[model samples]
Target: MAKKTKPIRPPADPLPPVIAPRVSAPPDPMSIDPEIQKMADDLSAKVHSPARDLELVDEFLDLYRRVFQQGNPIGLNEDITAVLTGRNARNGILFPPASPLIVKGQLVDRWGTPYWFHPNSSYQMEIRSAGPDKNLFTQDDVVKNPGPDNMGIGVGISQP
Candidate 1:
């Protein structure tokens, strides 16, 4: 009687090691270039008190326009506060990090709440204020959606 032999199985390929996605830390405010710091100070000094929602929205629109004129590409996923304050200033500095408008490294509203920024595209951004209530997404919340034309010489506002 012939002895039954077990079939030899080939070794299975080892699974690849999982690599975690790399997340970059936010830029340090103190490490900003001196030239950019000077530019931000100059621009920040020109900003007037934004008491109304329209003013706040207009401020953001004007910034976009200036960035466009500088020939810098707007980052759709970039933080507006960082971009404005020279931390992640891809479009150059437009606001000073030590300005009164910035509270705890955020761009605050008239009520001292951080403004929420939504970048719809390279040429479109939505600036939202918590309004007088200091709460967002309510009837009192003010949202201004500035489109592509506003980044040019033209100005327009879209509400959503």
Candidate 2:
């Protein structure tokens, strides 16, 4: 029978101090990025439940395409939050009574990318997650619009 052996230990050396690359940092008391501050301000103003936001984005796109006859495409970037919340030029709340109001505003996705909402035109907007890559418009981007394929938005709908 083969005998088990204890692994030899290397000469004792002090362990290095733990350091990690922080993708995000706590807001400095005296300093803040304007873009991050914008996100914070938007969120603090009035956040909505993520589920509700999803429904709202989908519905808004559907209406613009189906009802308005504008054939608007959804390709949001970041400012779409203002459009949806009526903080933009539009005065009407397209989706009102923001449901399950838990978040103060557009919530950040898992990858730390804020839900970008950009209005391409009056009839079109795009909303998406930066995905794991944390970059917009990449192969990994989680698009809310789902483009022409609709990314299997519902049953019977299929993407190639």
Candidate 3:
């Protein structure tokens, strides 16, 4: 009779790799201004709301007014975003780079379209959101045409 060889057994299961939890850094204390902090809090409240488009614009106007005293960000949406998050910003970073509201360096609306900004004067600007349709200059667009002093006058959903 031939001698049977002992079969070798497989090694025990190895421990799974350890994955560290992701942790975001806290906002810088020195960079936090009182007014800007208040605005940040206010914006955070309405960031995900559907019926607060006008309010959101008002907050943005305040931020622009505070940062660029000469005028609002005078360019396309992304350019404006640069000023908002740049060195001259009072709050350091009103819109954090990793924020969902910011996409590709531009502040995007709920429909994922960069907001259209029309400067009327040194202290007034018309902010427009593409609205649910995601098309500019449409009836469904939400617009905030601030008065000569950035006052809310003809602020509502656009008509045709």
Who wins the lDDT comparison? Answer: 3
lDDT of 3 by residue, 48-135 (tens): 5544655665576677677556667678888777767654545456544445667898877777888878777767677778788888
List the lowest-lDDT window of 10 residues for candidate 2.
151-160
What value of lDDT does candidate 1 attain over all alpha carbons?
0.57
Q: What is the alpha-carbon lDDT of model 2 when measured against the actual structure?
A: 0.47
lDDT of each: 0.57, 0.47, 0.65
User: Per-residue CA lDDT of candidate 2, range 1-160, in tens?
Assistant: 9999999998999999999877887554334335434443443443754334444555655543553356543333323443444443324333332422223454355445676654445555555656667776665665543444433332121111
TM-score of each prediction: 0.48, 0.34, 0.60
- How high a TM-score does candidate 3 get? 0.60
| lDDT at residue 116 of model 3 (Cα atoms) | 77
User: Which pairs of residues collide in candidate 3?
Assistant: none
What does the lDDT read for residue 38 in candidate 1? Answer: 56
Please write out the lDDT profile of model 1 over residues 1-160, one tens digit for every residue: 9999999999999999999899998875456566555544443454543334445444545665676564223443235566665554354555555667677777776677777665656555666666677776655666666445434523322354
Please report the candidate that would top TM-score against the real structure.
Answer: 3
Candidate 3: minimum summed lDDT over ten consecutive residues — where?
146-155
